[model samples]
Target: MATCAEEVSKTKLVVAAIDFGTTYSGYAFAFQKDYSSDHHSLRIYGIMSKNGCSQKAPTCVLFNPQGKFDSFGYDAENRYAELTLTNEHQDWYYFRRFKMMLYNNPNITWHSILKDDKGKSMNAIKVFSAIISYLRQETLRNINERVANVGIKENEINWVLTVPAIWSDQAKQFMREAAKKAGIHSDQLDIALEPEAASIYCKHISVSRRERQETHGAEGVGLEAMCPGTKYLVLDAGGGTIDITVQRVQENGTLHQVYMANGGDWGGTKVDEAYEAFLEELVGQNIWEAFKAKYMDSYIDIFREFETKKRTISPDIENRITFTVPPVLRDVYEEMKNSPLSTTQGHHRNRKLIWKGDRLRVDVTEAKKLFETTCALIVAHVERILDKEETAGTSDILMVGGFSESPMLSNAIKERFGHTKRVIIPEEAGLSVLKGAVLFGFDTRVVSLRVMKHTYGIQSSSLFRKNLDPDITKTMVKGKLYCEDRFSKHVKKGQSVRIDEETQTIDYHPLDDREEMAVKVYITDKYDPEYCDTELCSYIGQLLVCLPMDVPTSDRGVKVNMKFGGTELSVRATVMATNQTTHAEFRLLE
Candidate 1:
């Protein structure tokens, strides 16, 4: 009925976003037609599990003894539990909440080793690739079911992977390589900064404004309430890290970052750790260890229940919060304490511990204290950002993340900043990053500007000056005096970089008679440095350029270009003689 060209032109553009979080992971996508007509209708969904439909799946992976991926998410948890029953889990690799490894790793690379829960080590790239592959397959199946008679092609779809804005370039590149191994082409993949993605999605959605106005005052309801150039702060509190950034809205609905992205490991999972510590303190450490070893399924169950309860807890709640204790843990506690867990024992000796059926009830005040450690850190970081000179005039705070859904956290933030700034928590704050990533895939230019996290540059030689430069860096090249380790800055720290902005071009020549040149890329926190060996500076990666075989050493000069505006750094080198150009493959230092 239609020509091949017509049929080809009818191919749809689908955007799929994979939000790989530290404690959880999920995928969300939208068809271009649906997103363009009405952005509000584009509801982001995640993989369904037997337990229920959730916005994210637990970021847990289970691999067999052969080092092959067995299952992921709840399935992985269930499989590991089954294996634990037979004492076979020791040989299998089970990784859970492992995404933070990249963030904490100072020298993250593609060849890094990731240790699992049992201390079993595997290639980080393989581990990430397996998880990404599972998500991709599951998402593709879901897409097939959603659309009828409209077959999707890989080229027609754009994929966006979300990464923490605070992560280093090596970490981001590691994710990119892992995605490529999972079958996504490098050209089709776009990396989205978590906080920026969340901001973009919240900017378009009006529900947050409507809900805020209905609950709080009508002032500072949404982006529409503020005039153009008005600034606001976005706090993306996830399971592993809380990233904060200040951004101003542009006239064309674009966004510009006002401050560099910053935050720490104070996230929702910190509260879980506090709760676990409470149990360890309530019962002796030996008993707690035994309980964990013998009743891991029960341990997971307790936390799973706590996860649900934690979200609903508010500072105003009068009743004591209760959690179901596994029978085995209860037995262990009794055996260790030599008495039953009740109101008159352990840390809360004066308070009454109500035992309703198999559940342990704790006072609301005690339960609320568990959240204080993490919530306090979040508030402190937000205040620090607000105190910065760059964040001046920021009157609104947009809180989005799984942790932001916690009633206690919301109230704490509101109580602290309610007088000076309006706090807006969007509905389903957990899915904001995933959905916003999908929006980013559709249009990467939504975030018009970003602040450079670090000063990126290359190590090159410059003519050594007697008075201006140090003697240690002086070297002789081709009988010419030079500073061998001179820091050639491509982008300075805290510089405002617009989307697609390219760094200034610099010319480089082969150091030796060899026909190849190596460009060493380095990053530092210092404002400006004369040498790359300064404090807080580290070598990240290198780019190799090969000259034509017949070209002379003098003609082997290459023009190097670097771009630091996006989530990752990009480098391109062109031979000056033949005009041949090639993208540099950055190899991270081991």
Candidate 2:
């Protein structure tokens, strides 16, 4: 018989999964908890927040009255109307879609990003830190609020954060740094790839469960397999970027043969911009332009407000929004008033129009059409790779990330590939990766995914010649650009090499007379730099090859030996040599 005292030792720490996405972020936690009939259930998972109402959290933040939080999640969403209006003071505001802005602007800093729409100074990271800090606090709070939320302290908790599969090491490095700056514990931190994380939730232990439900139909059932050499593609179209990765699944939480991941900077937000453009066209460009010129920030504010209303109502119906703005916008206001468009209502409370004007609206069908360029290209790319003459037997296509949540997007996929190989949209489309990271962080049995590393280079000349698109090509280099690439085989742009790596070495010297040593490690997939000109993906750090000067002199070529690691291949290149030692040491540094 077990004593009650012994039962207290059975509980373990809870694990939190963080999905730090460009558009939004979310966290989930799991632990063993006591259940009905005095039994303990393992792998109890729940969304972490003040209230665990939703599994995903919007990664947007805003400043409220007096620079306070007017709303967060449903709280903020409910009062979107009240929050949209400006009062006595013409204070600025903030909203989503700033992630890419930081990259485009070189002057952007932690303080620089927090500025309101008016360019007023504020601390963006500080606000993000506050939100994340509150999240961390609320996780502990929610854990405490639960029946057995138990007595878990912050120190006892473990967490893992997931990033886009296409995120560069620099991005991950930035995240690690930012996570720390935001007060998140490094010890609690673990990094996992986005698609791999989603696979965890998609292929959860349901089949392994004692009882399972029938899984199949027109929507398609996910084929869950955690074995060696299982190949899959992760089509992650999110708010800001589209990340596509093709890799072989390993037995453990490791990836192999991961070469086929690429991303397009365009995503849903681009479509949203196009949508705004369409609405502007419906309202007349001149009118919209006038509004923009007179009231730049207010123009953006009004557009955002229109977008909010668009989300809720039918495009056929007339709708109105009321908000105040700078007085300079009065000209545009008069034009809108005089226009032939229907004026459903009017009120001038805060130096703004409180009127519903015109029958201008966009139907969902038209909205989807606006996304044609984006959707078609994404589909075409995926199809092109999948239909490659090689690897015809590849297993399946796994669609993960936030963009896959789009009903129109998925429908387009289903319409296109209904009969082909399996197309799976994981059940937990959004939070799947975060959950997968939780399981991955614990070293649990999982199908490992692999992605390749690529080093890019440009031709010594003509990298960007006139009438030519910048040549972008992938090369076989290993490791980080300035680090260990020589030891690693990374395939940049056009290199369709298999997703694995082996080591190799080559040696050569002396490009000029009396120089004794001049070598450029031209590692590339293209034989001719002219034809295969890609933009400079990468280049060698300044490394000069020079002879020992004490070596014997010669007028003929000399041979130098080099070795590559994984491939274990070696080569001796004969080059112009004026001097050489019978033997010399040449090895990679520590």
Candidate 3:
């Protein structure tokens, strides 16, 4: 009999699906095997990881001023000061969300982040890339070094990448590009919609009481337990963006969502920004106005001083901030009845004024308000999706996202769906999508990839409409080719096909023979090419199918054969023509 581990590894593919999230990134790999003593059937073992790291990794990076990498994760965060990062370089090192920038702006290139040995902050893609690259290396290390029991070769591992549902195809392509640069294998690469991945992952953990026993491995749908046609609203709040998707359970376990919405760019990072702005405003602006107005340049460290005081104290209603003022304080505001400050000890050529009190506290309340505002925006958007789903007859919502981890947000969801049914939030909310990415990767047939020009096979002229029959469902055949019949495969509506090699056989003498019953290669749905939607199905490029000199163009349905490149397809088709009858070979391209 196969070992239990072998059995578990049967259903699960021993590969990792990386969720390169904007705020956080993580990977999950499943190990499957055959474990039945009587009947040999595959069993699925879940993803394994080290320590408290359950298949997820922090997405922060750090480097030093010497352009040398300092450290990453907890290490850099702790000993930031020792790193001596180049904080002076405006373009070099910084720690901030670049994902939004990637989408919103085309000019911004990813530069790694850096921080001093104290770990303040820096700019560099090296830090981010290092963190990402290291995690990838760890995955390989565990597989090659520790995947002893798993029956898979090192190169066999496939990787599925998940991205936001609202992301543009161009943006997703860029992600794919970054992954390529990161050394992730291209064939192993795939992108899953984050919401869908989370939904799939959440389904595995179990949601309701009535439906639980039918757990048939990772891809097993909770069809039996999908809460029987209940509605759910996903209020996904994360470190960077918040997304909301409303899903409805069909007779089968699949979730069909009608509405998808979200944009909480104001996540945890926003809170930090709000706090920083508060400090920058009070100490930098307010104090500087008073100092600069008095012509005292000695107080250069005014902003830094305010930062120190703010950090030393915690939030307190009774005044959490306090810093001693320099003796020159009397010389400043009260000195010439103009803004000013005096030095404390007067050690050098001159000392400037220093004053601090309750400045940090002034922004605390405002910061909290900003945080709440971002959270509220996320919640409101989720509610809107739910409302739209209800209109579309989609009554169930499966809540998933990093922000769903927030108790504050969770309560809001419970209250929103209180009168109705309820919302389902996974225990490891953020990781749900990471897990779902695996599920999505495991099932590539149904969830095939959709790409721009690369994955698309364009038909020269789609005959969607015909003048002869307004109601004829198949309007494509109405327009017959006068010169030649060309075969187009590897492309169709809602179908995926790639052109391994794209080629066109030209009617070389069409221009020369324009008056000799010339062939006009035009795109259209109507039998009369002139009546088609020329703007949409117009001729982008054309190839003329020339009949032999002995045959007339009007009488010949010249068959043109074009073949290019090698890509997967459900069915393949070929068109062949010589002098007379048109011949074609067709296959389904899934």
Candidate 4:
């Protein structure tokens, strides 16, 4: 049996997880004692919605004129809307779906700034930290209210924060710093990839045998029933990004990633953007821009209404899709164009656009078109993954996250691969990541191995060769020729590494009597990159090792060891002369 290596199940009395999503956010937790029991259950945060209890609230935050956190989630949305209705929200800052800013941002750091819904600027870290703080408070309040005499101290609780599998290392580090600012100690927190967490949740849950047979045919029965060596695909379709991961089960009951996580920004928000684009064209760009600028509250309300209707959209629906059109939209159009909004209807080539009193009616055909591009891209990507030799024999595609709840997208997947592959959408798919994160906190060893997405290495200098080293990169060090910016690869792309496995130690000598040697980490998409400064290479983080003054100049060397198996990269250096190990943390997002 695999023992708990982290503090979650051992030293911590509670394991709480926060799913800080792009469009929605929520928390779940279970006591340690309960976690050890077979009857343990996760207490997920929920708020009442039109469809009943909602496991998550909108991922939005409100700040006062002083730029201090005012509220978050549903409260923030409501408060901002109320202020907007009264024309008093101009001074206040409101941020929605701001998490996407970190995605693909190479220069993202603690000092990065973010613009609010009204273009007001604030420190991005502050905004993220405030949201995390609110969630932390909520988690504590719930734990206190639910349990008796638990007396859970801050040190006794382990926290898990979920991020998309496709997020960059800097983004993950940024979240860690935000959590630290929210009063979570670095040691007590663990970053869980969204797709991996969802996989862990599926691993523990059982589907009805009859339902599994009806859906999967002869491929597999359910997630829990999958024996060792069974490979499947996980599509984490969230609001901001669709993260894909191919996983295979091990005999030890742990997941082994067959392929690195890969996906694009083709998510639910893309469909919303498509709908907005249609509306922009129908109302005229000038009118729509002015409406969003002046009537910001009503503009938000329009999308809020659409979000509710978006869930109910289906390919089989015959009636025209209807969206409540705030009166301000027409007023803004009239004010700008000196005519009713309907006048622009004739200008639209898409004859399906029509105005029905207080509602905007769109033909089912046009509405389906909104999902066409995103669905097509997602399908194509999935097909490409399945076609790869690595993902061969993968018969099941597990869909999780908020976007997976879309009937239209679900239909798209089923129509495309349902004939040959089993597409399993777990119950309460949106909460899968959150619940699984809680489980991950309880046992961090559920994922035994992972395939590296990029080739990771350290920037180094070695003896130059005329044929292999470019002339521009050749430089003299201590009267000898050396090649700068050489990539000393620690782990290659597509390489499988067990959890906490350390790479082979490489010794390095300080150049030019430098007091400290900097281990600059770089990553690349290529399997083998020779240079670190190439177009395809990206410098991620660095670790500095101090050289001992007592050691001779030539003997001042450090043996660097890097652990590339976990969600974050860890480095430790051993002094060559003293044989003493110095664990150094990467200064990520600096």
Candidate 5:
């Protein structure tokens, strides 16, 4: 007879993934039966949104004056704009497209506070927890309403949250804590890297030749080109950051990462910034600020339209592009400049600005310039990844994410690597991460191995060598000379680690008569470091283990185990004398 715990463990019927992107966020889920079927037979479902059944919604959140979450996604945008119209938004908190702050933060902690668009500060954990709770509630409601006759219990569903590969461990932990506050247990949650999830999703779904022809023309090759053991690059270009990784197909239909993930803030939002800068230069900063302050809603609408238009602009576009300027902006411009608008070029002759019946006409050449810096950086980074010694023989590139759908970016990559590599842009590139994350929750083994992004280790005291050890790191404990802050490396950067692989056991003893021992964890970008105080090395967190008071100091030693195969770091401490083991809580450094 099966026990209750056994039954519940075996009854995992659903896998849900939340793709919390920088500019957009959404959730997707799949039933176990459907996912286990043939790739062609599997039918993954996304959250049904107001603007049709879409995979994602805008990553926007609005709070009331009392700092309570009022709305999320597109609804939040509308609600904030409505409040702005009544001059009530000054006190209310409105955060839009703000997920990049985590990526850019150097010293993120659980107590970190985030600033709203208007510079109002709020507890980041509360803000993130509220957004996650809203998504969870909506997902549960959707499951009950859409899936008929399937009384799915909360325990039967597995949740996967997606994060960027370049994020620090502290950032990942912050998200984990936020999710727990949203009512999801740690056991039911899994952290999936954005690029890895997209790779798995693409590997399972076989893109048809006809679909490839429609997008990539006759030269387009689908997943059929990738046989077992074939290597390919995954470029996940989202709104805020671009993440690039290389993976190879395994014989059992899994993926193995060939190169460590690498990217930067060169995503689609950079282009938006460049466009705004161009507008500021053309309209003058004073007039632009006035227009924005007086017509905030109109400013948002113009960018909303640009979001759609941006995807259609191709490298081959020759005609002058036109953007409808709000009447207020035109009136403001005239009032500030004290003259009528004329067809004149600003700074560049090829880039001319003309007004045609309340519409701002820009040259296609100039519009393409806005994407030059970001697109070039993406292409250059991809080139460097392919040039690596480990990435040899890789001939296919898979582009995913919302920004990957841009024709300008797609054309740029194709033009650069078209001769040597076949670029495969899967259908609905924007939803790849969201759907791939769902597949990851179903079977994490799909990605067999991952490369360590940083060299992780513990700061410890070692026998000091007179010549090799620096005097600055020398310390005396109990009349014995030791090298303090010595970095004990467990995992090296760029080292390929299999899933769930544990590092060699490290022995630790309590210092003096203390009942607790603190293990300071440190990480560095360098492959090897002598001490934690070296450049590029940072103290991330510490794991504290309590020792039994009755036991002698010699018997109070504990064995520390670190596992780096998964996305987040896991540590366990086992007392040698009592043989008792407990998970270590790594509190982020202040």
Candidate 6:
């Protein structure tokens, strides 16, 4: 296992982190001097929400009709809502919950397109870049106006962006590209995995120790007090993804990965999806669709209300879940159906949905049902991770992220794992990622090790074997038969790796007389994949290895060195003849 320690650039005087979440987003920063002594040195920016000020505003952006950036966050939301009221939003682009585009997409490229609220499409990179740029400016403004006496130079600040641990390299790279477009230099930025950052933030928190001891006995010391070999699980349930990772504390006060992070799209947004489905069922699907189309402002309001209500909902609540239904919904429903919403076909059969002037009271049982599927998936996934051999010693469950604040989810986890492990929901669970990312920016080595989630390799030409290689992969190479698309694995799945460790150098020769070699990178779920074109294998990106044209094809060689220990994979290639070294830029889109 690779165990080299990693360090951030010492020239950086301050660390700033942007937690670009699916449902909400925020930024935090702390100076290097305040990192050790002052726990309250970290300053989290508060954005304006409908409820007033919050640590995070909704993750959203808006563009004017001229295709120029307008506003972001709650400001964008309020502006777009006003536009919708005046029927002026048709040409204006407003996007919300767009981070899911990266999660749901299998092929994310620089040119990937994102659709706005009205199904209008814009370049995905542009959309992401706009949000990141807004955050960057806001953070800099905060530091200049409130935190620092003198203006901080962009180069003097280390920028960190938090991504879900389960995200694909393409997604991570996409964020990097967006950050670059947003004016953050590649040398100054770091990608901190969501669960890993949360774990680091929890590591310094001592207030939860008493609660842990009282809840799960003496063995359940807080993460701050964890012994050298103590193992804990981090469940980062965000709006878009439930990222879970098992961590083991090392003797040096660093953390090692017990298991790779894993989870799915079953998050807080899943509950939103379920609620929308329920609404569609209660009101006729066509009517509901019409309502969303014509009453965009009201539709947004409904979900904003749902977002607030989702956090407070509990399994023990007896009273009905009262949602303040906007008057526009009722008006549109009656206008479209030529009758009151209560007399709808679906509502007539279900007495659980009570409609009273602008107030839609849903049975508590029904409201709780919306959470069942998502909560079940999260609970089951954690159970499966705990059952794994690598995580056998883990006895503490550290919950963090915006969705972890849900009482329903908190209760479900405790009810299931309380007897076996201590379930900890740290204070301000939502800000853990934002705050932890700032800490990660200060010290990249906080997470000293990580487990590989996939077997990573390069596609190369190999000597064809009659039985082992398929006939389709056979090709003539200098009168000798060779197999194309062979997987040359550098790192196997489940291998432990350190942040600074590089894979063993693998030398390769040009398959053809081409001047440059395409070092095609591939990843697979299988431990030992044979062919790069297999169903389980995915083509991630490729690096162009430039070979000296003066050298003969037979003499051309490049030594490939790959590093998969960090959040992103990096490649370095050294030419054999000139001894010239070049780094590979994994091009995702073309």
Q: TM-scores across all candidates?
A: 0.92, 0.61, 0.56, 0.93, 0.93, 0.93
lDDT of each: 0.82, 0.49, 0.45, 0.83, 0.81, 0.83
- Using TM-score as the yardstick, the better of models 1 and 4 is 4
Candidate 5: worst 10 consecutive residues by lDDT?
1-10
Model 1 Cα lDDT, one tens digit per residue, 1-590:
00111123234378888999987899977887877788666765544444653568899999999999999998898888888777778889999888988889988866799898767899999999999999998888888778758877778877788999988777888888899899987777888899999998888774485456756677776434445787999999999999888999999888999899989998898999999998787667899998877676777788888888888889999997887777778788778778875543234546456664567888898889999988898898899889999999998899998999898898889999988987888888988899899877777777888898888888998889998888998999889889888999889999999867778999987778765677787898887877887767888888676665668877878888776766777667888898898545566635
Locate the minimum summed-lDDT window of 10 residues in model 3: 564-573
lDDT of 3 by residue, 1-590 (tens): 00112123234446477766665666666643221231112232334333343334445444545666545443433343232232233322334245664445433234433353234554434444555566676667665555567546645666666667655334454555556667865556666667767776655555632223322344434433455465455555666666555555545555554343345465555644554554334335555355433332223223224323332333233332333333332444444455543223232222122233322123234423435665576667765655652435544445566656555455555666645644566666767787777665655432223212221222333333445423423323334423122223222222222222323433232212232222222233332232222353433222323334444544333434433211111112222234343322221100
Candidate 5 ranges with C-alpha deviation above 4 Å = 1-10, 37-40, 52-55, 208-211, 214-225, 343-350
Candidate 5 lDDT tens digits, 349-415: 3456776455888888888998999999999998888889999989788899999989999889999
RMSD of 4: 3.2
Model 6 clash tally, residue pairs: 0
RMSD of 2: 11.9
Q: lDDT, candidate 6, residue 160?
A: 90
In candidate 4, position 288 carries an lDDT of 90
Give the CA lDDT, 0 to 100, for residue 400 in model 5: 92
Q: Write the per-residue lDDT of candidate 6 for residues 460-526, one digit (tens) a residue.
A: 9989999989999999988999998799999999999987788989889887787778777889989
- Model 3 TM: 0.56
Q: Candidate 1, clashing residue pairs?
A: 343-353
Candidate 4 TM-score over all chains jointly: 0.93
Better of 3 and 6 by lDDT: 6
Task: Give the clash count for model 1.
Answer: 1
